[model samples]
Target chain A: MKLTDAKAQFISSWGAFGTHWGINRTMAQIHALLLISPDPITQDDIMEQLSISRGNVNMNTRDLIDWGLVERVLIPGERKEFFTAEKDIWKVATQIIKERKKRELDPMLKLLSQLEQIEGDKKDKDVKQFVDTIAGIRKFGGQADKVLDVMIKADENWFLGSLLKFFK
Target chain B: MKLTDAKAQFISSWGAFGTHWGINRTMAQIHALLLISPDPITQDDIMEQLSISRGNVNMNTRDLIDWGLVERVLIPGERKEFFTAEKDIWKVATQIIKERKKRELDPMLKLLSQLEQIEGDKKDKDVKQFVDTIAGIRKFGGQADKVLDVMIKADENWFLGSLLKFFK
Candidate 1:
């Protein structure tokens, strides 16, 4: 495939994949575009290339920045702001894992812990099942939390080399 | 909190959480209901409890079963087919991970590998960047695939005890 066609295909596929993982299509497309770009690009460039509305570019760009996956760049002697994605996929994954752990996992684990304390007789099958389920989830989430912490702190070599080896 | 009220809260929250993870709310809600129920229930029971259409319940339950998180239970002398969720949270999570890895991650890595072979001038910065990005993602996906394979094969005790200890 030609480079341009390949890039377009990659961007669209990445966007579709992102949708299944809770990220919106446009956001992932924008990230894909920025990743393959040799230089930081202006919002107008993104709008023109992706054929998206200005509002969409602005909103998703801000969301990406908030997620720490993208950054705003100011060119010397240039007025319009530009954006760039974190090009290192490993760091990008780590950042996403960190943010999602904070946003989704931590809060869900907290709720599960509270639910486990629901006042009930242990002898009641319903109560016992509910408590057991909650406790199980909390324990699993806690282990995941620890593992992710280690990954976020470690470099890609350590994770891909040491960790993967150990897991294997 | 009262048992009924607590169960309602758990169901709603689980459904909401499921949305963020690409699972539909109704499917997650059905799973939650089955998880908390001490006995297997019929489609009519699910419809009544969730106040959803019979068709909706039918569809999501089938999906849950397909994901291997829910199963059909036959009660002797009972004409109706009852359903129950895998109450062990560890099993439920492993099943989900296994399914999603097949559905999303595996295909994604395959695409990235194909994209990596795009005909291009290696010296061109854009070509280099595109190839590098695809390679990085493929590597990460490969590592995740390996980790998930181990998790799928592991029993709950081995995963929670030995794996957690090794990672820690």
Candidate 2:
């Protein structure tokens, strides 16, 4: 495949993948474009390349920055803001994991804790089942929380090496 | 909280959580309902409880079954088919991991492999960056594939015990 064709394919596929994971398609495509670029790009460049509106680019870029996966880059004597994505895939993965843990898992765990305290007789089948389910989910979420904490803090070499060894 | 109110809250939250992760709200709500039910429930029961149409219940239940998180249960003398979710939270988690790995992660890795073969001069900065990004993602995806494989096959006690020790 030619480089340009390959790049287009990657961007398109990443967008589709993002939709499956609850992210907007245009946002993922912009991220994909930035990921493969050798230099930081302006919003105008992104708009032209992705064929998206300026407002769309503006919104998605802000979200990407919020996720800590992309950053604003300043160019000397340049009026327009430029953006760049973190190129290291490991760091990218860790950043996503960290944010999702905070946004989704932590909240779910809190809800489970509250649900576990529902007033009911333990002998009732409905009560027993509810408590058991909540407790099980809470325990699993707690374990995942700890595991992700370690991962977000560890460097690539130590984390992957230890994981490879342990899993092996 | 009363048992009914607690159940309502759990169902609502689970549905909301599912939307964040790209699962449909109705499907997750049905799964949540089945998870906490001590006995198998019929499609009509699900429709009445969740205030959804019969078609919606049928469609989402089929999807849940496809994901291996829920199953059809036949009562000996009943004419209607009943459904039940895999109530073991550990098993539910592993099943989802397994299905997503097969559906999404595996295909992504395959695409990355092909993208890695894009023809380009290595000295060109764009080509170099593209190749590097693809290669980095492939390596990380490969590692995750292996880890998820083990997790899918592992029993809960052993897997969680090992992960806790390893991460600690």
Candidate 3:
């Protein structure tokens, strides 16, 4: 396959993959472009390559940076910032997981704690049931958080390598 | 907290969690409701409990069924279909992963294969580079799919047990 066609295919597929994984399409394409590029690509390059507007590129780039998936690069004799993505696929996935957990799980853990503390209405079966369920979900989420912690640590090949053996 | 208040909180939070995980809000909330209920909930119950329109309830319920997270339950002497969720949290998570893989990964795999078959423009550096990058992603995604396949088979306590050994 020709390089240009391959690049387009890669970008489009990666963007679609991103949407499925809960990231926006454009954001994923930007990351994919940066990921495979030999050099840091400027906003103009990304815009030209992806046929996206400046604002869309800027917003998604910031989001990618926030997620620890991409980084900005400075070119000598150039005023515009260039960007590159984390090349290690595992690290990219790990960072996405870690950041999402921090954003989604931490606050949930706190809220569950608060909900558990609320006094149930003894006369109200519905209220009692609701509290009990929240309390249960909190317990479950706590365990899931532990699993997340384990997965994060397992980013090292040692854990996966050992585990991959058992799958056999 | 009162039961009504607690129910509202749980639904809202679960819906929020769903958004992060690529599941729509109403679908997740409905599942959350079913998870906590002592009895199989009817369509009316779901619509009422969620305060959603009938069309919204029908659509998301179908979606949940398609995802294999929720199922129809028949109550004696009742023709109306009732709904229930997989109670075991581990099983619930496993089904989610399996369904998501089919929805997201399967399509990308096909697309990657088609794109890879595109005739190469050997003379163009750009085309050559692009093809190589996408082919690399195809390799990466294929490996990911294999890893996920192994995990999906380790249902419920089997997962925890395997993960225990994997992380050991």
Return the TM-scores of chain A for each candidate in numbered order. Answer: 0.92, 0.92, 0.82
Model 2's alpha-carbon lDDT is: 0.91
- Superior by lDDT: candidate 1 or candidate 3: 1
> Which pairs clash (backbone N, Cα, C closer than 3 Å) in model 1?
none
Residue-level lDDT of model 2, residues A48-131, one tens digit each, is 999989999999999999999999999999999999999988789889998989899999999999999999899999999999
Cα lDDT for residue A14, candidate 3: 84
Using lDDT as the measure, the top candidate is 2
Better of 2 and 3 by DockQ: 2
* Best-first order by lDDT: 2, 1, 3
Q: What is the DockQ of each candidate?
A: 0.59, 0.61, 0.38
Per-residue lDDT tens digits for candidate 3, residues A74-162, read 88899989898877655666688799889998889888888776666546655555556666667767887887787778746686758
For every model in order, the fraction of real contacts preserved is 0.71, 0.78, 0.40
**DockQ, Cα level, model 2:** 0.61
How big a share of the true inter-chain contacts is recovered in candidate 3? 0.40
- For A48-164, candidate 1 gives per-residue lDDT tens digits of 999999999999999999999999999999999999998877778889999999999999988888888888898999998888777777887888898788877776566455754
Instruction: Label model 2 with its docking quality class.
Output: medium
Off by over 4 Å in 1: A156-168, B156-168
Q: Could you tell me which 10 consecutive residues in candidate 1 chain A have the lowest summed lDDT?
A: A159-168
| True-structure Cα RMSD, model 3 | 3.9
